[model samples]
Target chain A: MTSLILYTPSGVLAKGGPLKLAAKRLKKLGFDVAIDEAALAKHLRFGGEDDVRLEAIHRVARARPGIALATRGGYGLTRLLDRLDWSLLAASVEAGTRWVGYSDLTALQMGLLAHKKAPTWWGPHACDDFGRDELDEVTPDCFAEAMTGALEAVGFRTESGFDGLDTRGLMWGGNLAMLCSLLGTPHWPKVRGGVLMLEDVGEHPYRVERMLLQLHQAGVLASQKAILLGAFSDWKKSPLDRGYTLKTVVAHLRSLVNVPVLTGFPFGHVPTKVTVPFGVKGHLVVQGRDAFLGWDEDHAHHHPGHDGHGHDHDGHAHHDH
Target chain B: MTSLILYTPSGVLAKGGPLKLAAKRLKKLGFDVAIDEAALAKHLRFGGEDDVRLEAIHRVARARPGIALATRGGYGLTRLLDRLDWSLLAASVEAGTRWVGYSDLTALQMGLLAHKKAPTWWGPHACDDFGRDELDEVTPDCFAEAMTGALEAVGFRTESGFDGLDTRGLMWGGNLAMLCSLLGTPHWPKVRGGVLMLEDVGEHPYRVERMLLQLHQAGVLASQKAILLGAFSDWKKSPLDRGYTLKTVVAHLRSLVNVPVLTGFPFGHVPTKVTVPFGVKGHLVVQGRDAFLGWDEDHAHHHPGHDGHGHDHDGHAHHDH
Candidate 1:
């Protein structure tokens, strides 16, 4: 079985039940799940004090599990970006530890890409996606297949328009707000000609537009081959917003930038998120209304040593679609 | 008589009552006020379409009023930043137009500073601050005084710490979220050894902290002489936020950066706001619990040609102190 470590490096885990349940589910899925000792440590709204959370991160990196997952994301990783030992995290990646999680984890993943050119996964968190009262069937299955190296590609349907579009670039980005927070910082990855994937929750469309405009104004969007927009969910509509909706926002963005802006990617603060490899080279193909992002099976299967399991987990990526 | 132009460069007015009321109030305060032709134009949530707003800006610059006040700030300026004619605006500044407002106006103000090194006022909006049923006593008095070149310094009381402390640097920054949005963009003003002032409304402390950390990690805070924090108001408390408050946020930020973080500035999205000059050199002095930010009187009075009113506006900056 592939060893996996679950830790809380961002928001505090409200109760231990969810974490325990997540571990139980992962164990059943063939992961030798071990929770970090200080995973449940609390400090204000964070999982732990800054130093404690920092130490837990280094501890997980040192352990070098086949998969290192975050419990949940609220807002803590940006605080530790300055003090993080990127080399140690990169070393763990070299030793086959596939760091996984999205939202707040974008800070760590983007920082790793900027500092050490290491890849991580933009996937479901241990608690948020797997430990719910009603689990997302597709989430766990996709995560399991990806971890076991049998998942090489993920596909979704975007708005029709880019039907013959095909491009290849480094896959990058995560929670839109988290990615924007790293702008102008040392941790900001300067990935030119990359396909940027973006998603957010609870941010109004205007704010989403503002951040996208920031990226466009910074020349980040122009340098990319394509812009993949995932779910922008949970935001409330204001009375002030007469006809300005997310659709209008996308239209306005399309008018502003020449880069192809594709929407409806199965990711973000939603339950059924696909496990995509951040920092890997991905080939994107659009056929009719369907978009497929595929990576080399060899590269996706990072941990060759952990492939001794006889279980085959292919074709799980299409279940969510 | 000093000529002041009122224009809507950002959000829609919703109704024209406030703009009319604001103009009447300004006229009562002894100024010849004129509303822009497209001041009340509405397109979705913005005051007008992008081109119309952009034209209104250039039109104001061409008219060369003593004061150019934004009607309100909702979310339109960032879209116009790239298309703005900086030299025209700078020329208007040189010819004596005191551009003023906060919130979304931060984008235009910072862009002016970055492109042409011109100063603008971080002051009140025409509608939001002046058009209310019950007006704030200190706001109009401060604006009138500051416009006439009589108000040199504004003081406030803060937590006791750095007594007898004096530092001088360029004073910049407004609307924390707007400022952060410009980061990594060409419009980001590279102000070193500056006294950075920041404030916002409706953003959780965690988001505020993340933006501050971005500035800190970007080396912006380390390069600043001191930081002036105004009101971070309008955020609601969450059950998960145990003891996490704006107070704790300031404490955490102070622990990370070497710059002095002074609070209690009378600004932000509040009724009683002081009119302060943005992009101008300011002298900051601390005595016991009192802090005062003083700018050169000659510089504060940008419109020397309009000073023939024979009205003494001195001593008004202390009214709110």
Candidate 2:
């Protein structure tokens, strides 16, 4: 039984034909899927949306063992989250399941982490899977091995050295905007010594810089061990925008802290994304002669859909988390 | 010398021009004025064209004591703030100078509070004086009294009753856009029991809602005594904008917390703004009756220009804040 459920909030994806087909593809991949249309309908302010969404959650939770996935990404999840019974979902996940998605799906995932320590994955969803054409063998191998817990993630090794080298800590982070909203709240993990990862879409470079500065200024960046820059794809600078550029943001980040700041990774609002298990454990190593992709059973991974996989971890290939 | 300095980082108010003449008018009404084009230049990134604007910070610190005011607002202050000598500025005013202005001026005031505990005022500036063609006497009287410490802020009563309200704290806030940027940053105050005041100009209703949500989600709106929605003057609901309306935003806030939410008041990016003293100890009464404001000062009123007269301590005043 491959554990996977598809949930949609904000109808941005639920009603979209393309998104529906996106779910079918996931179904074809071999996973149980479900969509919380009520959560999606909340945006429309329609009656009975809550009941509809609640039914979807119950179906997924009762699925015995499965990973819950978001159907699509847009805006509206923030509203539904406050009212949802997160603990109920958590109890089901603990029984046997995980959650995944990014983009606006971030609000749900981060909320879970903040509200209940419900472990989740920052990866592709029903509609935005990193296609085979898009990801090479190594990347897929990396994904396959991670879900099945065949590998432990040895975080990024920045090309640039940690300016004031010699520091250690746990790891944490996610979509930039979501992470910013977490600051000052109980949701923000105590990421001291932890590798801090960040990536976002739809924001200009300056807004990105402002957010980074906000984090740094708020004491999060200063507390982290090594800061990792994930995939910031297609995010561009506004033509008339005179604010910070990506390079400038990174440069400024490096200048502000003694910690190592590295880029050229894929863990944000991108197509070829990785399922990063934040707050677990990881190390920041420079991509030198010592750097190579590797994965083991320590980090969890999963096949698309499998009503028959069971609690077995041996089937997952090894690459790196 | 009057300890108030009229500081404008972005917009330049011509000296002896319309703006300076206006300041002279205020000064004639018994208020002291100090305009630092250099500080304003630094604030506006006066890189070259206005090279004289490159005057150093010790100079900014050496301000001729009076409410340090911004000429007009633009956008270069945040950039220059890091280079600002906050300690020196405070040292320059051993007593305390009430910093005032809104919009672009918010960055400076927030920076001051963030860098160190400096009292800042969120209100009108020199240009506002010109707009008071009809309310000239009242404008200059309040401006002079506020600057010279001759004016005593009276009681604050909101039309929205203070019922169910049982709290008191300092009142703080400026522009909504400014608040968004400061989230998760050291620049934000510890809004506990604080009467959270918000205002903005040109922002669409949805944008305002987004910002308010950002504040609420960020946890700033959690424990505040009351949420005060200030003038949304010129605010629009974009023809193409989607999501929540300002009213919905207010309702959403009320739904999330038990705090009293009040609206329809002045104190945004408008002229004739009330000089709000941020960081001072203020009493907030949200009950249906007797909504009072303003902090108590043992010295009450101090003057650098002329006789201190305006004495009213109920904290009530009908001016923008």
Candidate 3:
């Protein structure tokens, strides 16, 4: 097994010793693991130097041609994304190095997708992803497939009795704030006909609705065949927000677009986070309360993890493997 | 002068005694003023039941006949944007009811633009834009011109040595978060070849950068001809992200696309905010230290608000006007 290069662009992992644990865990994965100590220190000290962060990325990508994943999300990658050598990074991606992370890691994911058109995942870090005992198999399978270049299947399945919507296009979107932050810049991708999956954590319903409004006004939400509602974890309401919730946000989305809008996706900042690859062409078909993910119109034999071909009120299509 | 109507969608204003102050100031515009008290109360009390909020908009739109603006930047319009009886609202707009405000007000702007294709401005609100003495002539002029169709003669002067950018399309965009809030929904308008202007207040530079990154990844950022940075007031950094600033964020944009990028344009949560009309085609050119705004490639003028651009090494083509 190759080594894992851990980076903390946001300074989250650096502060609480998440860095040390990350390094040790990756080491157990069977290869030499390294943490960008200087970069971590810089973030821990002064907090925002793209140079240190970039150096870390380059060094890891150069030395270990395997995987580069963020440990936790705080809030610094956006400040450095544009300045990073994206072209070289793109070349590097083509040269075969996988990048991973979620939450604030969305900074890197959005930029990579926009600037380099590189494929990435809307999944979890090693700590949250593999650290759990009851870890969902879907995420791990997807991760393994991507890392090992065995990701041939492109499908998802919904629960029984779930309302289904069918969509065919390249996948786009992840965290709401990350998506909102990229408006009026070169990093937000144009999702004319896309399987736009969205989720959030800790945001009030009104805030989520506002971000969704931005996507619609910017034309990013238009012309899509289906809308996928991913897992929204721990979203809160301010005392002043007057009881609005994500349920209202969902009803609002369904009210606006004729496209089949489905909710209950399990791929976001949750414990059972699924590794969803951005910038890949795929199809989503909703049959009653179930949804099936597939590469084409026929989603017969293949199952999309355990959550396929069922009536999933939560918007996830469960399929029997 | 006509008194302005104060419309509150979130209803938070119902508790504040100053609600009358907003009405009083707009009354100074030499016209009778009124507040949508019922709608304001309902929006704040019941939340997304925008029936009252929409009624407020319609009432002011019908009664005032011009510049139907929002009272504050909170979270209600996204829920109300679609349900607001936009076709009736469009008829009112055609009869000349101009709407304004940034932040959450972006929903109204986008709704008006997408449904009616009306030109809407990123103007100030009751507390900031309307009722303040620090208001400048340039702002009211831009807002006035766009509303009255006198945008041609209300010409903008470029900063000296600011040769300005070269291009054209409708200018669109608003609060970074508000725009992104509308993603995967129907409210976002298609922005193409237009100048994508953005600004925010009290957000981390990294956060701002992430929102921008998200837009780019969603494919929303590529279609714009130029990227305009509006006034970002008091947008500071966390101790965790001390070194990275908005400047670093701009540098990232500069390193990305060849499109003309100009900073320091006035919009967002600032005292001296300018009103930008979305859905209208226009051109934005930035040459060296100066920037120009025009309708198409045919005409080019200096950026209206600055005095001899080049405030810092940051390519901020702004003037005090």
Candidate 4:
């Protein structure tokens, strides 16, 4: 059977209920899910002390499971970036480990990209998605297909003015605030001509605009092949901001940068989010308002000569990039 | 009489009451204050649109007054940074115009330092300080003294364990968030072996820790002679954090970087604040928990031959460094 480890590399899990619920669900779905012993440890809003979280990450690398999924994402991994063993984590990926999660996981994923060029999944976490009152059909199916190498491309309807637009480059980005925090740091990925996607929660439109402008000033946004905007939810409007909204932010950015910023990217702090293989080479084609991100089936290789598990992989599967 | 221009380069003044209050107070103190016409102009939340604000900056440069005091600092200068004429502002400074303010003004001051090695003041804004119901004696005296070149030194008490510590470097930094926002951007000052002072309002201890760590990871903290921390006020505590306070953050950072972090800086959102000259060569001396920052007379210069405003310039003034 496909084996996965639920690791806590960020904020502490408040209760064990969600984790238990996720493990039961994943097991019922015919996967062996093991929770790291220290996953529930709490220390002042963090998963644990820095050393504890660092140990969890190193543990997953040593185990080299088929999937190493994060238990949750909050704010912790950025503290451990400088001390992480990037090569060991990359070696795990080379041995068929597919690291998965989003939100605060952006730091680790981007750090891996900057340090090792390793591929990671920008997808659902254990508790947030599967542990819900009723698990969403889309998220699980996407996660399962992605983990088993049966998924390739995901499509979404974007705004108009992008018809006949086609570009190909490596896919990277998550949580806008986290991505911008890496700017000018060693953890920042130097991905020129790459498809950059971003999403966030609980940040007002003005703050969002501020961050985007920082990237613009740093020449990061313009360096991208295409800008994919995901969900920016859970932000409250301020009384100070009259007539300014997320739409205004997008319009302002569009006026500044020379890149096509396509909205409606179905990812980030949401229930029905899609799994994205970050740092994987992909093709972006926009036909009118409809866009698809895909990769070549033969070129999208996970690992060579893997000791096959119960997770099935069809080499003939095609992805629309 | 000492002449000052109340310029609104960031947020709108929201009311003319504070401007009038500050102007009256300054005139009573033997100074002539002129309020910028665009100070109250509101374009959404900013004082004006990018071009309008940019024009205001250029106008201030051309009109080189004794002091260019920002009416208030909320958030707007970062937008017009890429388009700012740094040489013009530097020329204005060289002509004896002392640019003053803190918080969001960190961007403008740091940008000037990075681009032209120009000096600016890290101090209170017009509305926040002079417009208050009753002015604190220390604040106005400090401002008056700094502007008149009568104030050569400001002293404060710091924590123990730093007695007998003596170090000297260029004085830099203000408003932690604004400083971090400029990180990885061209505007961020690449100051080496500098005495960096920081303060902020409404940012929790964890957020403060994260920004500090970002600077640390970027090799910023270790390059400093010493880190002078000012007020971190008005942030609410999260129950999720078990006893993790700003003190905890400082202790954690001290363990990571090998730099003396002295607290109790009487600056920031508080009423009783001191004026600091950014980009000035100064000395830091610690004596049994008491510290003083001072500069020399002949070595201290403000733009060559400043036709000397009515503000007193004894030239024999000695600052406590």
The best candidate in terms of lDDT = 1
**Order by lDDT, highest first:** 1, 4, 3, 2
lDDT of 4 by residue, B1-321 (tens): 777898889877677898899989988877788887787788887888878888888898899988999989987898899999999999998888889999889999999999998888888789989998888877887788777776667778789999999999889999988898898889989999999999999888887988898899889999999999999999988877777789989998999999999998887889888887888887788889877877542233453333222111112333343
Give residue B178's error in model 2 in angstroms: 4.3
Q: For each of the candidates, give the backbone clash count.
A: 0, 71, 105, 11
Q: What is the interface RMSD of candidate 4, in Å?
A: 1.3
Computed on C-alphas against the true complex, the DockQ of each candidate is 0.88, 0.25, 0.23, 0.61
TM for every model, in the order presented, reads 0.96, 0.74, 0.65, 0.93
Pick out the ten consecutive residues of candidate 4 chain A with the lowest summed lDDT. Answer: A307-316
Model 2 Cα RMSD, 1 decimal: 6.7
Better of 1 and 2 by lDDT: 1
Query: What's the TM-score of chain A alone for every prediction?
Result: 0.95, 0.76, 0.80, 0.93
lDDT of 4 by residue, A2-90 (tens): 89999999988888899999999988877788989889988888999999999999999999998999999988887898999999999
Cα distance off (Å), candidate 3, residue B243: 4.8
RMSD (Å) per prediction: 3.1, 6.7, 8.4, 4.1
Worst 10 residues of 2 chain B by lDDT: B42-51
In terms of docking quality, how is candidate 2 classified?
acceptable
Task: Judging by DockQ, tell me the better candidate of 2 and 4.
Answer: 4
Tens digits of lDDT, candidate 3, B103-154:
8787777767766676666676775565565555555545444444334311
